[model samples]
Target: MENIVIIGNGIAGVSAARHIRKLSDKRIIIISAETDYFFSRTALMYVYMGHMKFEHIQPYENWFWEKNRIDLVRGYVTQVNHTEKKLLVDNSRTVAYDKLIIATGSKPNKFGWPGQDLHGVQGLYSKQDLDLLEVHAPNKEVCKRAVIVGGGLIGIELAEMLRSRDIPVTFLVREKSFWDGVLPQGESQMINEHILEHHIDLKLETNLVEIIADENGRAKAVTTDKGETIACNLVGLTAGVSPNIDFLKDSGIALGRGVKVNRFLETNIEDIYAIGDCAEQHEAIGSRRPIEAVWYTGRMMGETVAQTICGNKLEYKPGHWFNSAKFLDIEYQTYGWVFTARSKKESEAHFHWRHPQEKVCVTIAYHNETRQFLGINTFGIRMRHEIFDRWLTESRSVDHVMEFLKDANFDPEFYENYEKDIISKFNSDMGTTLAVKNKSWKRIFKTA
Candidate 1:
């Protein structure tokens, strides 16, 4: 029996292990210092907001691992000896393996600011971070105020978590607008206003200079780049994250911004592979980044890598970009290529429509010359992912997509349809009266 060792218990590692077990009878061992079992990392915010407990985030029951014959080790990996095919654990134990998988995922980025190592100063990434938050900011009385240092998704999530407990939050975003670098101007402005409406002290164009520490080495306040000092009990450093591959520094594995791997997720060394956020491709895949920290991509990578380990080599090809996120209470989803103001290099045209009374809007991007559909970003509305994905794959024209926009909607039957309004706005903007066409259910459901 071949012993397969995986270095992380995240979704990538667990997915690989499960798929490998189904294909082969190999013995698998997953090791992690973060937690004993795999749990949903994205659900950490919900846990803090009292929506669900820690155990609820775990998809599998405790007995599932034992029944599947997968071994779980709760220890830190200090080093990996590629030549000997062994891992050195913190307890000085040596674990030998025939094949090794590195899916260590990401860690919070720190820029070596002054007093950033204080007790109350932390980043929200791991379960340990949540535990520390529970200790530092148990309630509104305990945590008088929290100053967040970044304007990214994690920063806003931490702000929402703090707000759920009636704790005051001061958000410091270096960007002039909230996430403008990634979102369109209209959407970014709307989100900025929405965040402000939530009573958060959103300080735009601000940067953190240093974290002030009290006598006991706890964070007391934060100093900004403008020389303004804001007193606070906790400081959140949600700047960003980097691949967690420090243990592989001396392990003879090639690394770029992350562990360098081919499309097959294979490392330079034979019998060793990497997946998830820790795996960096030689080039970007379509519009997807080289290092995608998204959960579904990680899961897909795991499934792809498992086939190769089981004797059926497969390449990782994640087609058609799709992602969903929430800004405060509003739900946002985007499929295909919706470029930001900074990244809009091509000759494209945008048609944007928003509800007069609600925070709902949709922006469609398409090539100006060819009229080929590029992407769509919808907020406060539900759209079928498979429909847009198929349309993008087929290279549907903007006019064709708009003519049948009502078919892609995933809202309830009683919910109002905005297809007519969206079509009207598009026609009014483009100076073309393209009437909506009715199609049978078979035609609408047909694959492109």
Candidate 2:
């Protein structure tokens, strides 16, 4: 039997293992220092907010692994001796394999601010980080205040997590407006208002100068770029994350911002592959980034690589960019390409719509000349992925999309239908008399 070893049993590694098992009977061993079993990484915040338990994040029962003939090892991988096809785990134990897969994910980025290594200063990424959060900020009394650095999605999430426990939070954003680089002016402004409404002290155009450490080496406060100090017990470093590929430094594997991989996710060495957040595409795939940190893309890469290992070689092709996230009470979804002013093409234009009082809005991007629909960003609304995906593939026009807007709505019955309002706004902007049409259930449900 061929011994297949996979390091870092995240969604990518487990996905490849599961698919590979279905295709061939190979000895599969998944090693990770994080946990004994695979768990949902996205649900870590929910676990902290009392919505779920640590064990509940795990999707599979303990018996499932044994039944599937997949072996799990609990140890930190210290080194990868690729020449010998062996891994140094815990700096002592050695494991050998015929084929190896590296699915190690990402680690939070810290830029060496003073007192960043203090007890109360940390980043939320792994289960260990979640555990640390519980110790540092269990409640309002324990952690009086938390100062979050960076203006990205992770920063917002940390603010929400701290607020759930009645802990006051002061958010420090270097950007003039929160996520302005990615979002439009309207959406970013709306988010700024929504955040303030939640009672978070959002400080824009502010930078963390230093984190003041207490006598116990815990973070007590942080000084800003303007030389203003704010007292806080916890400091969350939500700057960003980079690929976790430190162990492979001496392994002769080519490295960019992440592990360099070809279309098939193969690394520089033979019989070795890398996937998930740690794998960087040799070339950009369409509008997608080389190293994607998103969960769905990681899952897709795993399934694609599994085929090659099982004698059915397949290329990793993640079509049509789509993602969903929650910004406090509002749910946001985006499909296809929605570029900001910096990245937008000269021929591209956008039509935006928002409710008078509610936090409901949508931005549609299209070709200015051709009127072909390019992408859309919807907030406080549910949309059908299949509908938009099919429209993109068909190269449907913006006018056509507006006429059939109701079909794209996921919950036309329960959710407040905004089709008429959206159509009216679009017509007002485009100067075209387009009427809203009833949803075609057949068209919405049809699969390619």
Candidate 3:
């Protein structure tokens, strides 16, 4: 049996272990600094709102590993010796492996400004961070206000959680709008409006100068770049995170913004693999550059590594990037060249606009040259938006979808034809299966 060791018990590590176990009777050992089994890191925000218990957010029970006969070692990984294939745990102990997997994840990026280490300043990352917030969980009498220092996904989620608990929240954004890097200026404005309408104060184009700590060593206020100061009890920083690569400094492995890997998910060192937040992956569309830090990407990489180890003939080829999130009763999404839509070519550059209400709007765009559905943004839509599924498979020119909408009529047959072409294209290109279930095409199709 092969001796295999995996560091970190996150989604990537767990998925790798599960998939690899099915391929061979390897002596698989998983080492985790934390004790919890696989759990939904994405669901941490719900815990703050008291909508879910910690137990409810857990993805798997203890029995999951016992059934697989995989060895679980609970210890902090302090160091790594790639040449010797050994890992140091808890200062004195070491474990050797024939194959090593590093899925250690990432640590929250500190603002690097002065007074960041103050008692009342926090970064929302792990369950530990959530636990700390729970201890100081907002109350009108105790903790009335909080300053969320970033306006991205985690920051937005935390703002909602704080509001649900009746805690007044203010968001400080470095860009001109919320999610500036993720969405277009117009889409960002729409979200910013919705955020403001919900009673959340937003400070745009602002930078954090320093956190002001009170005499008791707790954050009492925060100073911004514009020389404005706001009194607050808690300060949450969701700036971003860096890969957990301190242990690998002496390991002779290559490094980039994250651990470097090729199409096979194998690192520079022999018999060693990296995945999840710690490992960067090739993007599905356009440049195919490495993308770090997303739950779905981590899970996909984990499975791909396992298949490679199992001698399965498969190569990981990411396609049709999908991005979606729901916030404050509004669904928002952006995918593909939504970021790259500034090029010259108005007609060739696909962009459509729709305003459902005064404060609600929809924007969809595509890269006609690539026949790639670029992105869609919808605000205040009553129904769920699953345009991502269509965007993933559809090859229709963005103009077609736009033209269909201009007729002010619902032609299920046209949509059905478009969907069929997309399914066929995906199947031919990626060897993906796309069978309609239970003859369900009738439901979405218009019979002539």
- Give TM per candidate: 0.97, 0.98, 0.84
| lDDT of model 3 at position 183 | 67
Mind giving the per-residue lDDT tens digits that candidate 3 earns over 155-256? 888888888888899899998778877666677777888899999999999999999988999888999999999988889988877898877876788887
Residue clash pairs of candidate 2: none
* lDDT score at residue 445, model 1, on the 0-100 scale: 70
TM-score of 1: 0.97
Judged by TM-score, which candidate is best? 2
What does the lDDT come to for candidate 3?
0.73
Model 3 regions lying over 4 Å from their true place? 281-285, 340-350, 356-360, 368-372, 380-394, 403-448
Model 2, CA-based lDDT: 0.91
- Model 1, 392-441: lDDT tens digits are 98899998888777678776341246666777888999988988655532
How close is each model in CA RMSD to the real structure?
1.5, 1.3, 7.0
Ranking by TM-score: 2, 1, 3
Model 2: CA > 4 A from native: 414-416, 444-448
User: How does model 2 score by TM-score?
Assistant: 0.98
* Residue-level error in angstroms, candidate 2, position 52: 1.2
lDDT of each: 0.90, 0.91, 0.73
